[model samples]
Target: MDLKLVILFLFPVVIGSLGNLSLLCHSVFLYCSGHRSRSIDVIVRHLTVANTLFLLSRGIPQIMAAFGKQDFLNNVGCKLVFYLQVTAKGVSVSTTCMLSVFQAITISPRSCGWAELKLKAAKHIGRSVIMFWVLHMLLNIRVPIIVSDKRNNTNIMNIIDFQYCSVMISSKEKTTTFVALTLSHDILCLKLMIWSSSSMIFILYRHKKRTQHIHHSSISSRASPETRASQSILILVCTFVSFYALSSLMYVWFSLYIKAAWWLVKTSALTNAGFPTVSPFILMTREQFVCESTRKK
Candidate 1:
């Protein structure tokens, strides 16, 4: 069997797994060190948790294949794999959106619209996460309905994958319904993410611009942690836009066309899989404190 896909996917899986694990450990350490009560701590903890899910959803299966456990994921395994994969992907998207929105609210001006919103209402965040899980679970329940363990000439239409499953909607009506729902969901979520991220970018840009106008000699020479955090948020927004845009483009290409080349499939899968691999490094870049601590170790 060709091992090219496994080879191409190996680095991403290993890095994603390691990065998420480290992030989880770091979050735990922070909590133990009494940072547990901070709102940012809550966000970091959730982000770490979501990253771990992403690693398991995407990286573990590829790692298994890298070790020659290819067909081990059959039938029952497919259901579990697809369920976790979808759930994790959904969580990642939701969590990132939450992070962006949460940060935006955090930095809002006293007179800003969100000033009185009590935005991080921990109860609301928890409820939102629960609702996200429930909604995606229901939406993807049809995964098992459409996917099966094996493929045969008669059932080829229903078989989505050997390791993961999806609904096999072949009829015109079903296809139309699926396409409409998918497009609507994508448009709504992507719009919200873009708007939220762009707003943060504008706010940060204004802050940096204002800082430059003031005389450095008279002002505080030390860099504010808030400014560093803003830069980090900007990096994250750029990354989220870039990767999600690529993934969304690939999705459109696959959906709008019937003939998908082998390279296209591999590229799409690789790109989609690589997001979890790269996201942690971006987050880590913002944490100067953590990096300094690591260096001192």
Candidate 2:
């Protein structure tokens, strides 16, 4: 294994693991401290776990392969790793969408339709999270069936791809149908996130203008906590969209060209790992507990 490849895989794994773990610990601490966990907090706790699982499932296998342990994963190992990675990724996407939508509803005017959803959503957060896990697990069940350990054949030209597992589809129709379903699910989640984030931004802008008009020269020096939290969530959404786009593009390209160059495949993996690595820190910055903990320290 090349030293550079090891660093590429290991760096994100360590950073992502630490970030997610910190967020998880902080969330747990807040919940255990008799604080009423808000809907967003519950969603965030789940997101942190999903992100950690995503990093572990996706990064560990790559790191093992990079360290000259290609055979470390057998058929079952490949299936388990790939399946877990895909499911975790779906959960991450779903939780992020939920976060955006929850915040949008929280900040909406009382007369708005979203306000109506806020109460019911709060009550069903646990059930929604369970459904997310179940839906993704069922959606990606074909992953384990399709993925297997790559066979080593001395006769064929060996083009090293970053993926350790080879995907086998019994029929083109089944592959097409699976791809379509997966794409539809991802696009729907992305649309929901984009819509919620855009609405939040518009609402914030209108509120700011109204505040300026009412307060005239005496506008406050600092933004309210709600405004700050909304801005942070918006930034998080934008970051996720950017990383998700890059990852999706790479996935499509790699799918079309299975023999993609090693560096290209490595780049794809990095993009896939980007959001989980950075999002936790973004979230932590907006967390009140993190601020309180820091001051105490």
Q: Best candidate per lDDT, number?
A: 2
Clashing residue pairs, candidate 2? none
lDDT of 2 by residue, 5-27 (tens): 88998988999999999999988
Q: Least accurate stretch of 10 residues (summed lDDT) in model 1? A: 158-167
lDDT for model 1 comes to 0.64
Query: Which RMSD values do the candidates have, in order?
Result: 3.9, 3.4
How many clashing residue pairs, candidate 2?
0
Each model's lDDT comes to 0.64, 0.83
Give one digit per residue, the lDDT tens place, for model 1 in 1-297. 347766777777777778877876776786788653545555655666666676676666655655666565666666676676666676677777777776777666667456656454544776676677677677666555454444322445432332322324366677678667656765666677777777777877787677777887644464456656656766776776688788888877765655555576557667777667777777776566444534546
Q: Evaluated with TM-score, which candidate comes out highest?
A: 2
Q: Can you give the TM-score per candidate against the true fold?
A: 0.82, 0.90
Q: After best superposition, candidate 1 residue 187: deviation in angstroms?
A: 2.3
The window of 10 residues in a row where model 2 has the poorest summed lDDT is: 152-161
